[model samples]
Every structure is written in structure tokens, then in C-alpha cells.
Target chain A: MNIANKANRLTPYVFMAPAAIILAVALLYPIGYMIYASFLDWSPSQRIGEADFVGLRNYVNLMHDAAFRESFWVTVKFAAVVVTLEMFIGVGLALLLDRNIKGMSFLRTIFILPMMIAPIVVGLMWRYMYHPTVGIFNRTLKDWGFEGIPWLSDSTWAFVAVVMADVWQWTPFIFILSLAAMQSLPRSALEAAEIDGASDMQKVIHIKLPLMLPVLIVTLMLRLIDAFKVLEVIMVLTNGGPGLSTEIVAMRIFRTAQEFQELGEAAAMSNTLLMVLMALTIGMFAYNKMQEGRAAKMQAMAAKGTA
Target chain B: MPKIVLEGLVKRYGSFEVLHGIDLEMEEDEFTVFVGPSGCGKSTTLRMIAGLESVTEGEIYIDGKPVSQLEPKARDLAMVFQDYALYPHMNVAKNMSFALRLQRMPKAEIDAKISAVAETLGLTDFLHRKPGELSGGQRQRVAMGRALTRDSSTFLFDEPLSNLDAKLRGQMRAELALMSQRVKKNMIYVTHDQIEAMTLADRIVVMNGGYIQQQGSPEELFKNPANKFVAGFLGMPPMNFLDGEITEKSGEIFVQGQGFSVKLSHQKAEAARAHSGRSVTLGVRPSDLVYDPAAAEDQSLLVSIIVSEYIGAQTVLLCDCGGQKVEVELKSTIPIDRNGQLRFAINPEGVHLFDKKTEIAL
Candidate 1:
């Protein structure tokens, strides 16, 4: 009987073993390899076994590297700007569309179409759109008797163009998630708010936004993490042109390993990017844990009442 | 408090008409309850008055002002939803003071009002807890406290206690009665529970299929329901409906059905006399049938007990009268033979006759 009970308790772990093995092999292995590689003075020409061990040398060098510092700041700015614009535009669109109107479902489908496109395709599409004389944007401007703006040739314009393309592609993700959250909100509370003399704006502020905060926070963290590592769209559009203005950290890391062939520095840069994203992921999880902990405490009290 | 009137209020979703046309005048400071079964439009009517659902083809007048096109905020009211729609993120005090805060009231006044309502609702202890942290009963009280703090001229309740357990529902029903008395504001409560409607309503409006079947004082409606639906909808164990035909034995009128014949009371006989020899339904409450072994055949039904439900003090017996089903509510002390047949006399005053086709009281 004792053996059987032990076997019963082990059933769930036995079933979970396959997934655990796959996760270790597919995910943790690379991450461990990357962390080890970040500490070595390695190059593309030499095998990892032949590389010399360097303790925090790559990290120490990155601290003084002017190009690395510039790219880091650019990555932060791009993530901050794009995430902020996407959040506002996405949540605003969700609020506007969360209503009953003719052809609304079709409209919502159209809104999310940008997010469904491949990142490479989105980059190529926007690059053509941002072409100085031949692109749609400048062509339209010239047609209206205005000077054609050099979208990708100027530093500020290149950054702006990349930011625009990033916003266009990812804003739909935030919009769809926020719309689901907004649609699932307790409808009767809104009705009660209406009866409580709340205007439309007041209801959104006092009730809807507060209820949707959890989903919005999680969505924001996910967007920020994705925004920091964005490469294809910006690479296709600007390719770090106009003096590293649009060179995000991911692009820098790619060029460092490919063109410069400094594998150790690239790994260090990737690890640094991973650490930043890890902090955000941890913050998101901490928020979720706090919410769940409160809910569980309340639920335990409710169970006590019933018992 | 303002007098509320709904004139030809109609609600239609596409071509499907849910509420046909309802005309009602609710007096000031009245606790009027709209009671009906599910899909009977009692909630839809109340939601229309609350301005949640738009009036399709008519006008709602509050204090002689047309309000069909007005926003819900323009209607001076407070509503407690069936789900107790307290802001999940807000504490009890904040939930209660949400509307007052929106009005930009002074902090001290808002605090005072919230404390007063919390004290009355017994929510003072849980004032700092969010709705999620409170138990169901506490959340219900907080919802009530929120409405009370509003001090709106009209208070709307949409099956507010139907979500609670039976014992909690009884407690909340009593509290609601006390609150209505203390506030003396116009209260419109909607529920499918007949007991809640009977106990809490000063005036009960029984609705069915989008029409007001009957509306009057609780006692008046209980004594005389306008039709078959209202009669069955507003009573416990429901009024037993037996198909029969009205007939005259010399000058006295009687209602004859499959297993029994019952003499009509003098008042009902006159009405039955007009519709003599016509098919009708004999409606009797479960309370109207009394255990009596020595009653005359014309005044009693001979029925064999089928199932005996023992519900402390009272034993409800489902019986078969000939081939038709009839339910009887009896005292537990009453000696009943479960396998054998018995006789139960019908109270003359409790007999209700209705037209077979129209189901309208004759």
C-alpha cells in the first residue's frame, strides 16, 4: 500500500518528465552556453574549446565602448517610444471599436491584419513606402506640391521611419489583447456606473481602465520585451544607416558577430539584452503573483465561511 | 421622489419583439416590484426604466419629462445589479462613494455619507476590503451600501437577492424591506422569485410575455390575479390548474372536471353562470385544500398520494386525481396514508374560474 501511494504521488511527475527534458534541451542549454560564451575571448575563426577564458572582460569593455553605449541608448529610446505609442494607439482603438456597429467584426479583422504579416515582409513593405522620391509617402507629398522628404537618408527621419513601421506592425497585438480584456469586463458594473451618473469618459477612467489594468500591464511588458529585440523591420528599412541612428541593440549584436566576427562581444551583448528583458519578465511575474496571492487569500476566507 | 410613467414602452431586437408595449404609472415613494418568470421582460422593463435598454417605440416620463432619449446618467437613479456590480478594484467605501466622488463632492461630506451607509448596511468592518476580498453576503451589502450612498430619487434592483443562497436571500430580503421603509424613495425591484415579490412589494406588477398581467397592492394581486399566468406565477407550490367545464345544477353553478365536481361560491357562481356549459379551468391554491375524510363528494377531491416531500412542519404531497396531477400542502402531523387514497375539501372562497381558451379570469 505504501509503495502504491508513492507511485500515485509520482504519477504527475512521471507524466511531466518528457516536457521537462525537452525544455532543458531546447531552452536552458542554449542559454547556459550563451552565458559561458559571454565570458570567453572567442572569435568566429576559433573553436569555443581553443578560446581563452576571460573574466567579465567583455562586459568591462562594453562599459567603455562608445558604439555599444550609443546602440543601448537607441534600443531604450526605440522600445520606450514604440511601446508608448503602440499602447496609446492600441488601447484607444480598442476603446473605439468595443461597441456594436455595422461591419464591426470585419473592421476588427482588418485592424489585426498588420500583426499577421511576416516581420521581413513588413520591413520590405515599409522600406518601399519610405523611399525618398519614388515611395508612396514622398510621391503623395510631391503630388500635393510639397518637397519630397528623404525618409531613410536623414538620421532623425530614419529613426522616425523605423519607429513608424514597428508601431504599425505591433500595435495590432496590443489592440487585440486589450480589446479582449475590455470586452470581458463585467458589463453590469458599467451599467451601474451609468446609473451612478458617470459620463462615458468617467466610466472609462473610474471603472474600465482600473479593471483592465492587469491585462494591460502584462501586454505592455510583453510588448516592451519584443520592442527591445526588434531587428528585421529596422534592418530592412534603415540597416543602421544615417550614422547608427536606427541601430537597435539587436542590430548591433548581429553586425558584431557577422561583420566584426567578435563572437564574445556579441554573446555579451545578447546576454545584456536578455538580462534587461529578464528584469521586465520578473516584474510582470511579480505583479501576477501579487494579484493571485490576494485573490487566493480571499478565496480561502470564502471557503472558510462555507465550511 | 418623482413619479415615473412608462407609456407604450416597446423593446424589439431586429424583427423579434421581446416587449410588445407596456404602459405603467409608478407612484412616488412606492416599492413596486415587477415579478415574472425568465424571458418575461420584467428585467427588460426595469432596464428600460434605468435607461440601460433603449425604449424602441415609446417614451419614459420621469417627473413629467420625456427621458426615452436621455442617457442613463441623466436619469436620477441608483441600481443594484443582480450580480452585485461593485467595482472589483474599489474597496467598499470607495465603491459606495464612486458616484459622490464623480460629482466632485467635498471629501468630508463623502466620508460622512459613506460611513453612514456602511453603518446601516453593517459593512463598516469590511469598508477597506475590495469586493473580491469580501464574502458573498458582504459584497451584497456593499452593493446595497453603494446604492444607499447615492441617495438617488429612484432605486432599481434587478433580482438583487436571487444570487444568494436561500438563507442569505431571506436575510437580505428582510433587510431590503427595512431599507425601503427607512429610505422612503421610489424603489423598483425586478425578480423571478414570487416570495420576494410578495414580501417586499407594496405594489406587485405581475408580467408575462411582455405584458403586464396585473398590477395592484400585494394583497389585492394575491386575492385576485387577472389571468392564469399571474395566478400561477405569484404563489408558492403554484395555483393548481384543472381543466373543467362550468355547469348549472338547477340554479346553483358548479365546475365539473375529470375526478371531481366543486360548487362555486356565490360571488364566483354569478360569473360562472354567465359562462355556463363552457370549457374552463378551475384554479385553486395548495393552501386552499384541507385534509378532511368526511367531506361531500361535490366539495372534495378523492386523490391517491404519489410522493410525500417532508419539509419540516409541512409535508407536500404530490397526488393523482383520476389521471391528472394535483399537489397538496399538508401539516406534518396530519395522519396520511401514503399508499391509500384520501379526501381533501376545497375552500369555496379559493375557487377561481378562467376561460379555457383565453385563460382570462371569468
Candidate 2:
């Protein structure tokens, strides 16, 4: 009996061993290493054991670095703009497409096609189309008897091009989520709204949007986190060119590690980005927990009332 | 209040007709109930009257104005859906006041209307809480309160009480009866439960196979159902049907079957003689069959009781009369010889005859 009890108690841990090992090696270890390296004056040419303990010097240096500040602002700007535009356009498209038109399923499948393409391919396609003199956009402008605008060479236009590419590739993520949320809503409520004398616009504002808020908020947070870490697409497009106009923190961290050979500063930047993302993830979870708690409380109240 | 009319209302889905030209007129302040089984199109007809469904080949008129092409908002009516259809995000007060606010009514008036309806529904304390916080009965009341606050010419109910527990359903049904009396609006209700139809309706319209089988007061329908379906659909333990052949002996008409023969009453015998139909069915309600040992054998059923179901004040005995099955309802106090055959006298006034082929009352 003692042996059986001991084995039964060990069963759960035995089942959990593989996942715990993989998590420690693949996830926790790298995060722990990055946190430790952020406190060091490490060089890529030297081994990690030979690096001197710097004690917050890299974070302090980042605060004073003008380029880092500019890149930080640029990242914040890009995230705010892209997420805002994506949210509006994505939710708007979902509302407009949530109808029983012929071939609607086919149309929805076509609308999300851009999200399915590889990000690197999207960057290449946009770069080709944004060529100075030979691109389709300039060619179209020239054909229309207008002067061709420099799309990629100017700092402001570079930022705009990057935003456009990000929006095109990612708007569908929010769109699909919002559409699913809208489709799963209590249909009778919408019909009731119709009978309640709400106009089409009123229905969207009062009924559809309010009910879809939780899903939209989570989608917004995910998109924001992903927006801050955009690296590959921007690298292929502008490579943080035109006086750091489109240089997000992730791009700056990359250039610091590869070109500047400052491993500690790169690790510090990675930690900062991770902290911001962690804050957003925590905020998302808190909101979900609050919603779940509200529902549970309501259920308890209902049960008490019945009792 | 407005007089609502459905003229030749037809509904079709991809060439499959669900309602085959339903014609009904609901009087002002009348409580009309449409009752039927699933897929019987009672709800479809109600939805059409609410303007949520487009009429395929007919017109719905409210107060002599054709409103089929109008929006639901323009129809001057409110409906309580089966699921309550309360907005999950809105509190009870907001839900009840939604339509009034949309109409741009004064805030003070909306508040007054909401408070009044809430008081009537006993939802005063829960006004600030969302629909999720309320119990099932409370949500149902809120749905009712929402409709009540509308002050529309007609109120539509689509099985609003079907979701509640049996006890709560009974309570809400009583409340609805009182509310309908006080409100005095033209109310159209749809339900598959016969008790709801029988209890609350001023006029009950029994439908089957997407067609109106019969429409009348509850008593009229119970006493004289126009057809076999209406007769069987309305009563509890559902009016028993026994196949028989009408015959004459010594100038007295009798309906004879395999295990029993019943002499027809004068009024029913005259109709039976005029029916000119070969096969007929004798209808006897459980309440019509009274246990009497001294009753005439020719006018009573000789049935061997098989199963006795005790339900409080009454016990229903399922019996086998020859090869056919019959049921009887008696006081639970009555002693039973479950294995032996017994006689239950058939009430003459309750003797209903129908042409078996057409299932039409003779």
C-alpha cells in the first residue's frame, strides 16, 4: 500500500517532466541569460565568462543615446499608428462583410490572403513596387501626368511606406478576429436592436461594437506587441534607412549587435522590448481575468437568487 | 390598439413552402395564441407579423395599413424572444429603455416608463445589473418588461416561457395573464405547449403542417374541435381515438369496434348518418371515461388496466381494450384490480365522431 501511494503521488510530476525540461531549456534559460547579459559590458569577440559586470550601465547609456531615443519614439509612433489604422479598417471591413451576400465565404477567404503570404515576401514585393523611377506607383503617377514622388528615398515617405506594408500584411489578423466575434454574437439581440428602432449605424455602435469589445481589446494588444517587434519586413524594405525614420527598437537592437558589435547594449534593448511586451501581456490577462470574474460573480448571484 | 390582419400570408424557403397562405385576423386588445408542434410554422407566422420575416405572397395589415414592406421598427409592435434576447452588455434599465431612447423620447419619460414596468415585473432592485447577473426568471421578466415599456399597438411573444423551469414557467404564465389583462394590447403569442395555449389565450389558433387546424375560444375548441387533429392536440392525455364502423340496430345508431360498441347520442348520430363515410373514429377524452361497474356493457369500454401513473390528485391508467390501447383518468383514491378487466362509461356529450379517411369531424 505504501508503494502504490508513492507511485500515485509521483504520477503527475512524471507526466509533467518533459514539458518542464523543454520550457527550462528553450524559454526560461534564454530569458535568464539575456537578463544577466544586460548587466554586463560584453563584446561579441570575447567569451561571456570574460565580460565585466556593468551594473545597469547599458540601460543608463541607452537613456542618453539620442539615436536610441529617436528609435524608441519611432517605434512608439509606428505601433500607435499601425494598430489604430488596422483596428479601424479591420473592424470596418468585418462589419461591412458580415452579411448574407452571394459568394461571401469566397470573398472573405480572398480578403485574408495578404496575411497568409510570408512577411519576407511581402517586404520584397513592396520594395519592388516602391522603386524610385521604375515602380508601378511612380509609373502610374507618370501615366496620369503627375510628377513621381520619391517613395523610399525620403525619411517621411519611408516611414509611410513601412506603415503601409505593415498595415496591409496585418490588418486581416484583426479583421478575422473581429469577424469571428461579430458572427458569434447573440443574433436575437441584433434583431431586437432592429426592432428597437436603431439605424444601421446605431446597431454597429451600440450593439455590435460593445459586444465585440473583449475580443477587439485582446486583438489590439497582440497587434501592438507584434508591431513593436517588427524586424524582418523593415530590414528587407529600408534596413532602418533615411536617418533612423523607420528604425524600430527591434531593428536598432539588431544593428547594434551585428554592425556596432555591442552585445550588452543589444541584450539591454531586448530586455526593454521584452518588458514592454510583458506589460502588455499582463494587461491583457488582467482584463480577461476581470471579465471571467465578473461572469463568475454574476453566476453566483444568480444561483443565490434562485436558492 | 390596432387590429392586425394577415391576408394570404405565404412563406417559402428556396421553393419549399413553410406557411401555405395563412389568413388570420387579430382583434383589438385580443390575446391570440398560435400553438403547434415543431416545424409547424407558428413561429414563422409570428416573425412575419413582427416584420422580421419578409412575406412571400401576402400582406400584413395593422390598423388597415399594409405593413409587410415596412421595417420592424415602423410596424409599431414589440416582441419577446424565447432566449429573452436581452442585450448582455446592457443593464435591465438600459435594456427596457433602449427603444424609447432610440425614438428620442425625453429622458424623464423613459425613466418613468422603465420604472413603472420594472415595478410591475418585480425587477426594481436589479435594474442596474446586466442580464447575466439575473436568474432565468428575472431575465424572462426583463424581456417582458422591455416589451411592456414599448407602448406599441401590438405585442408579439415567441415561446417566451418555454426556457424556464416548470415551476417558474407556471408562475410567469400567471404573471403574463395578469399583464395582458392590464395592458390590453393586441398580443400574439406562439408556443408548442398546449397548456400555455389553453390557459392564456383569449383565442387559440391550433396549427398543424403549416396550416390552421382550428381557431376559437379555449372552451369552444375543447368542446367542439373542427377536426381530429385539433381535438387530439388541445386536451391532456390527448383525446383517445378508436377506429369503428357506424351501424344501425332497431333504428338506434351505434359505433362498433373490436372490443366495444357505443350508442351515439342523438345530435352525434344525426351527424354520423349524414357523414356518408365508411370508416369512422370515436373520440373519447380520458376525463370522459368514468369508472362504473354498473354501467351498460354496450356503452362502456371493457379494458384491462396495464399501467397506472399516479400524479397527485389523479391517476391515469393505461389500458388494453382488445388489441387497441386506451387510457383512463380516475381519482387516485379509487381501488384498482390491475390484472382484471373493468368498465368505464363513455360520456355521451363527449362522444366525438370523425371521418377516419379525412380526419374531419362528422
TM-score of each: 0.96, 0.98
Q: Tens digits of per-residue lDDT for model 1 on A111-194? A: 999999999999999988998878999999999999998899999999989999999999999999999999999999998888
Candidate 1: the clashing residue pairs are none
Error of 2 at B264 (Å): 0.6
- CA lDDT of A105 in candidate 2? 97
Candidate 2 clashes between residue pairs 3 or more apart in a chain or in different chains: none
In CAPRI terms, model 1 is classed as medium
Interface RMSD of 1: 1.5
Q: After superposition, how far is residue B149 of candidate 1 from its true place, in Å?
A: 1.4
Writing each residue's lDDT as its tens digit, candidate 2 over B198-299 gives 999999999988899989899999999889999999989999999989988787789988998888888888877755336898899999999998899877
Q: Candidate 1: misplaced stretches above 4 Å?
A: A1-18, A302-307
Error of 1 at B239 (Å): 1.8
Give the alpha-carbon lDDT of every model. 0.92, 0.93
Q: Score the docking of each candidate (DockQ).
A: 0.70, 0.80
What are the per-residue Cα lDDT tens digits for candidate 1 across B1-362? 99999999899998889998999999999999999889999999999999999889989999999998999878888999999998988988999999999999999999999988888888778788778777788888988898888888999999999889999999999989988989989999999999999999988999889889999998888888888888888788988989999999989898998988898878888777888899998999999999999998888889998899999999999999977889999999988788888999999889988889999998
